[model samples]
Target: MTERSKEQEQGGQVRELLATRADEVSLPDGWADRVLRDGKRAVGRRRLAATTAAVAAVAAVGVLLSGLPGTGEQPPASRPEWATADSVPQALRKMPVGPDTDVPYGTRGEQGKGALRVMLGGRAIPIPKEYTGLRIWRAGDRGFVYLADGPGDVSVVVHVDADGTSTELERTAKGEHTTQLNVSEDGRFAAWTVHPYEGRSQVVKRADLTTGKVGSRSYDDIDSVHGFAGDDVLINWDARVQNIGSLDRDGTPWPSADRDGGVEDYSVASDTVLLSTSDGCMRAYSIAQPDNQRWKVCDMEDVHFSPDGQRFVALREGGYVVSDTSSGEVTGGLWSVPSVHPQDMAWEDDDTVLLELAEAKPARTKDGMIAPIAPQYGPSYLVRCHVEQERCELVDTGGPVKAFPSSSS
Candidate 1:
């Protein structure tokens, strides 16, 4: 099968790790200035990359942020500063490291009843009972943007900070089906697709987590929502024609990558876009200077850029490879069970990856072909793989894995 079709087939099994899926939308005015302000407010540099997580076909809600909206074209006065946008290197260098925290994790069922049963740093974070079946994405060091199913047809969007203070950012409007929440790498903005029951058009809504302002644009046809680039939202529209564009915050649209190319993933740190060529090749391009190509790969499939934008992980040659983003050279490898099928892959941190895989044991059949001993395994597992060490440790073994270590099993 073709690479694109293979990735799509795998995408079904890889639901939990589909956070790297791309969609695009709009950002507000003074995006660069806002990014600069956030950078200045940063205290110390942290290497961890904040990324959004998404589940297949699930909808989330948009909500209120803490700050006041900016007046005129100037940056908002009340928005919290998080990172820089002056330069890619400086942005990565200046990213603030907040309180000690690990990526939130829990077994599959924990998202159902007893929501917020997720463990951070080995402690159970208490979540409100109303916020059931929570799907969380890392925001700031001590913060997260989450979507939870509320009473009735309601789904609420919320932000939780380092102090464990929960802020309701948004809740779904009546008769609205909100797509999964996608957060910027710096945790300053959240974007999602909204299908209102009253209309046939799709609306992409973006919430400024700092200014508490939400921006939206309507389109007759939207294929998918990519994540973010700096503050610009990436989107793919006109599926049949494959039109792609980077949407600005103030309703202005930025130059997009090749129209015929499909966006594979994005890196906010470098403002880079990884795209798939119409003919099935992959390349990385700069969103600011569309002509400035960073790297290209003709054979890679299911590419995921690291949180820092310096590296990426992809399934290549039937194995997982970590390659440098600048040169597209394989730098390291990840452990995987050939007998097991991976459903999804999420970056636990800059140097680590979390993979959801079908738990299976390899067996040799009469034909000497290696296959799973059984037709099915009980439940999938989240395996933590270290990039540099080339090793993997099981995180979900049908129970909590001890405080969910920050760097170790």
Candidate 2:
């Protein structure tokens, strides 16, 4: 049998076994209802111990038998002790100032209220007032990139240094909306897409920090900037072709493997571009050879690769799963969170991810059943999950705020 076929057959068999095992595990009738009742009561009484116990029980059962034969590889044998919400201290954990320890992050502040702030070591460092409405791209211990409303209603790219010095780069006409800013891993080149209001034409812009040179290219139907592979900017044009080339050139185009469904989102790494298809599959393509295709995972949505490009996290049915990039082996048990936004999730390190936890409200259904209500963008808290160790801790940020890891961290 071909290698791909063999892999498919093995995956099918393992999934079947998991399904059967789930069915064979017996529990008391109305277990979900009982758990909900007790959980609600525990929360009302402010008994954190009970809640932690309940969470631990659920996490214990989340480990699937992924060590079956034909699976690529197994996870590390030593796992850290699982942490509970109560066990995690209710204080901002101070990240040491060092080569690979500090994590710089940006928070959403009231627009036109004051200067923007980036949180580091539990302290808020203020940026210049001109760069007020800032959306951070690449943050590091040294410098960062962001987009803000410049003078004359134009959108300007601002680069800030750790010493509080800032420089405003190229300015584009403020369009109907602005896409996220993407910077190379080295914090040198930055790219983003601008959609003009009148013409409806899309432009991909890139700036080189070393030379202070900015260039752009206009495309009829360019979607957004994925990221920077090396010096080249990866573009998703027309929602059909994912091109990898220079910002000054036409570039090479690779047709989406799932052309019928289209590409939902994509992330560029050192050697490959990970594309999440709308039909719920993660596909990887070589940057050097666009035509080379490899299927990574199936039935997984909202896929994102870790910053280091060694692992990836994807949303499964009930929760999220982390897998090795090369082997595609499930390295950690399922991680459950309340109404997680996959796009908001990012890697703090190889073994940990910073996730936004949505707030849930109880709602009564027509049948007199109580259900939890959650909104896409609601009051959210940041939590750090240790994937391999199956532990999570709430990051005390004082209140609900959006946070992302600095590229250097």
Residue 355 miss distance in model 2 (angstroms): 1.7
Reference-based lDDT, residue 64, model 1: 12
Candidate 1 similarity to native, TM-score: 0.59
Candidates in order, TM-scores: namely 0.59, 0.64
Model 2 CA RMSD to the hidden true structure, in angstroms: 13.1
**Model 2 steric clash pairs:** none
> What is candidate 2's lDDT per residue for 194-240, written digit by digit as tens?
87766554777787766667787777777777677677777665665
lDDT of 1 by residue, 200-309 (tens): 43777777777667777777766556566566666555422122223333333444534455454433346566666565777676656666777777777776667777
Query: Total clashing residue pairs per candidate?
Result: 23, 0
Candidate 2 displacement at residue 132 in angstroms: 7.0
